[model samples]
Target chain A: MKHSLSSLLLAAVLPVALVACAPSEAGTTTDGGLSGKLTLTGSSTIAPLALEIAKRFEERHPDVRIDVQTGGSSRGISDARSGLADIGMASRRLKDGEIELTAHAIAQDGVCMILHASNVVASLTDDQVRAIYLGEIENWSEVGGEDAPITVVNKAAGRATLEVFTKHFGLDEKEIQADVIVGDNEQGIKTVAGNPDSIGYVSIGTAEYSAGSDVAIKLLPANGITASTASVGSGSFPIGRPLNLVTFGEVSKLQRAYIDFCRSAEVHDLVTGLYFVPVRTAQ
Target chain B: MKVKSTDRILVWSLRAASATAGSLVLLILCFLVLESVEGITRVGAGRFLNDPGWHPSQGAESEFSLVPMIAATIASTIGAILLAGPVGVLAAVFCRFYAPPKLARAFRSIVELLAGIPSVVYGFWGLVTLVPLVRELAPPGASLLAGILVLAMMIVPTVALLAFAALKNVPPGHLEGATALGLSRWTTIVKVVFPSAASGLGVAIVLGTMRAIGETMAVLMVCGNITKVPSSLFDPVRTLTANIALELGYATQEHRAVLFVSGLALMIMIVLLVFVQERLQRRARLA
Candidate 1:
């Protein structure tokens, strides 16, 4: 019995050992000269675009593997600084404290206020938006809409959108009296689309896509600047933030290739398809 | 002599396994306590019970008050239990006493199947279906009531299966005695069967409450996740579990430690609940 058990164990371990001993094919410059693994973590806003770019990059160089994860922009900065991620996706420009990391802008996305299509309110001034979020203006009629209580949908803490929105409106995060808190752009859009009385802010690209797809949501202009990819491209949108891939200190050959590919004209169609303006066009 | 030696080996191995299981719980408790110390001390233990609201990232305005979230968790768990407990127990009774044997087996299987469904699916269905339904009755469909309804649905099978087992365990002699005394079937079930199975029923409810309280996804999806003390059933609230889940992805230092504190709070609450259950069972036996 002991002999049989030992033989069974040997059989299980032999293949694993053989596989481990085999020469690694990942980093060998045999297929298209670029190969290895990279992990990009950060903003949900840039994740879809990065995923698409990674897919195209992988097809061109089969041995390259890119893993994309979304938490929020803060996580992106921290992960990059901590060396937990090869690249970090931040939807906003780096703050002064984050200068240790280098940022490469791949695309531009604007944050826009979204409401259900049935909402009568067409636009809101900065002060009006601030007042609504601060709970001073409770009813829609107070802001040129119907006589119903306005449902304020705010993003959760750590989300870049929430930080950008709060900073733009000069409203303190603590003071915003929100009725619902959503995590991602799609969830925010869905919440507003589902409720006629609700208002939320999300990525311009996601909102426009959802609206065009008949999701019953409309994007409200921010501070008289139209909330569209065109305005963002022209540098006219006030609430726009750069879609950045950040890295700390030195970059490896694989990392440089992937980052350059993300910024190149080759992936411009993927960026536009996702409703985001390419960095080259914006510049 | 050889068979006796093998029996002794099996007994010792079982003892070791049981000891390991028991010690693992203690180790987890110790780890949670150690990890939560920095957060609890920084935020001050008193603030956890009395602070106004949760605003962990706002610099000086950062308040790590866990009051509202604890209230939300307790309210939702109690509400879910109230809604699910009677329904589940009655369903079990019907299956045990009224339904034909084959039908009872089929019904039990369906209930067990309900238990098998993932909590995330329930959350999705509640968000898509129940949220809209609640919106018709009340504006801003995601509310505490929606969470309760979703939690109740998710824990029903747990309660029903446990209650069914409890009902099945009632001694047959007591039922025969009740029938011999000329009592009606319903009367006998209420007086003899229920009294005899009271302790087991208590355990069923306690286990169901445990499941309801520990649930995060379905409740998080439907509960609107607003950190406030709810004034009405329609008001939105955030639970302790949801707070940790929403923030843990990006939390660092103090923020991350506070999440551990939340975990400790949840563990302590569950332990207290188990203690209460033990006491109740003991008292029921004494009576």
Candidate 2:
């Protein structure tokens, strides 16, 4: 009885081992056929935008497949420069010393402060915003709000949102005292909406969408510039950052085609649909 | 002869499977050590253990101290066990002793169902329910207490189930003998039943502690991921698991290596906890 059982198990395993060693067919892409598989990774912000564009690009070139992944902007930059990905999606401008790769601006977004709609304070000066985040300003009354203690919501470490916010505020990431540490824009908005005295900063696009849908969160002006698509497009917002696609040195014909597709005017609507300003509109 | 051959093959295959499991653990340890070598050399193992500062974002001068994270992990685990241990053991006692047979069966099923619920669901429930309640009493809701409460809730079912089984394993004759000695119900339970099942209860406690220490999402959701040693129960602190989960996605060479070191430390701590538990159980059995 056990002999048959062992034989049955062996028969099942041998075929699986053979199948696993077999070369995958979809990996072969002709040099000039525009049918190769492309993997785009990094920047959760850019992932959805890239996904939309990839979907349309796939519709156009039925033989090509583009895989879009999000692991934050640092992952995108590292993956692209290290040749782990065809194109890396980054939500912020590239810093110095990342010269091995070239950044192509595909869209524009801004980091802006968000408050509960019930907040009596509609706008705060840049100094007050900085102080509030740095733990110098502790209560809403200090910033023209009710007498409740302020709940400062900040992003977790290694997030692009935290990096941008810290740089803009002229404070180190470690200096900020956060009441609640949220990972993404939705959580930031949720934290702010749930607490009347809470203040947080997130992508202008995500905050605007949440505010429009009556989620009880509203965007505040930064340094006299409103956090909006127009302000980001017109170069009035200091907190605005480019959404870039980075590739190392010279890209392949297939890579160029995908980059061109992402920058094409057809994606303008999709970019706006995500509440992000188009690169063309900004320039 | 065919039967003998078949039996030998079956035994060999089973031995091979067990060897695979054992080798996999060794493989994991080897990888962890290899990856952590850089971090151990960069910061020196002494500083990594002694220093409380963890500032990996400061480019070259970044510190990779596991002191605060380690303290937080232990503090929260102890806090969780303290809150859950008594409640779980008591619940188990009630189910085994006082409750009717049908009711006990129903209660056991409810606890088993709780054990089946995903950790993320517990996290979400804690975030939505317990966090707000904590916020009302305290200024900032995401504190060590909130983490303890969430972790306690997550581990109670496991502890209760195990404790129930431990108490059930105690011989009926032991209980009957205690009752015949004219001891009251509560005293009989405490003196005779508990001593008889002490080692099993120790196992239950150790398993509960492991679950609490290893829990990531629920504690992360409730514990403010502040990388400081908590001065009070209301203060927010980050655990080793939470730190790795939050930053591993974007961590680079040195940062990644340091996280591996933290993982290694966590593994060592777990081994030490199990060793202590075994010693305690052995001592109790001798007594």
* TM-score of every candidate: 0.88, 0.92
RMSD of 1: 4.7
Write down the worst ten-residue block by lDDT for model 2 chain B: B12-21
The lDDT per prediction is: 0.88, 0.85
Docking class of 1: acceptable
Please give, for residues B90-146, the per-residue lDDT of candidate 1 as tens digits.
999999999999999999999999999999899888877888788888868889999
Tens digits of lDDT, candidate 2, A200-235: 999999998999899988889887778887899888
Candidate 2 lDDT, B1-287, residue by residue in tens: 98877777777666666676798789899998888888899768897866648877667767777888999999999999999999999999999999999999999999999998998888878776777788898767778998999899888999999999889888889988888899998998999989888888888889899999899988877787888888999887899999888778777767888999999989888888889788867865674
DockQ of the two-chain complex in candidate 2: 0.44
Instruction: Give the candidate number with the greatest DockQ.
Output: 2
Worst 10 residues of 1 chain B by lDDT: B5-14
- Model 2 regions lying over 4 Å from their true place: A1-7, A10-30, A230-235, A281-283, B1-9, B50-52, B277-287
Candidate 1 lDDT tens digits, A1-283: 4444544555556558658968543322223468878888898788989999999999998888888998778888988999888899999999998999999999998999999999999999999999999999999999889998888899988888998899899988999999999877877887787788999999999898898899989999987778898999999999989999999998888888999999999999999999999986444
- In model 1, which runs have C-alpha deviations exceeding 4 angstroms? A1-36, A59-65, A281-283, B1-30, B276-287
Best by TM-score: 2
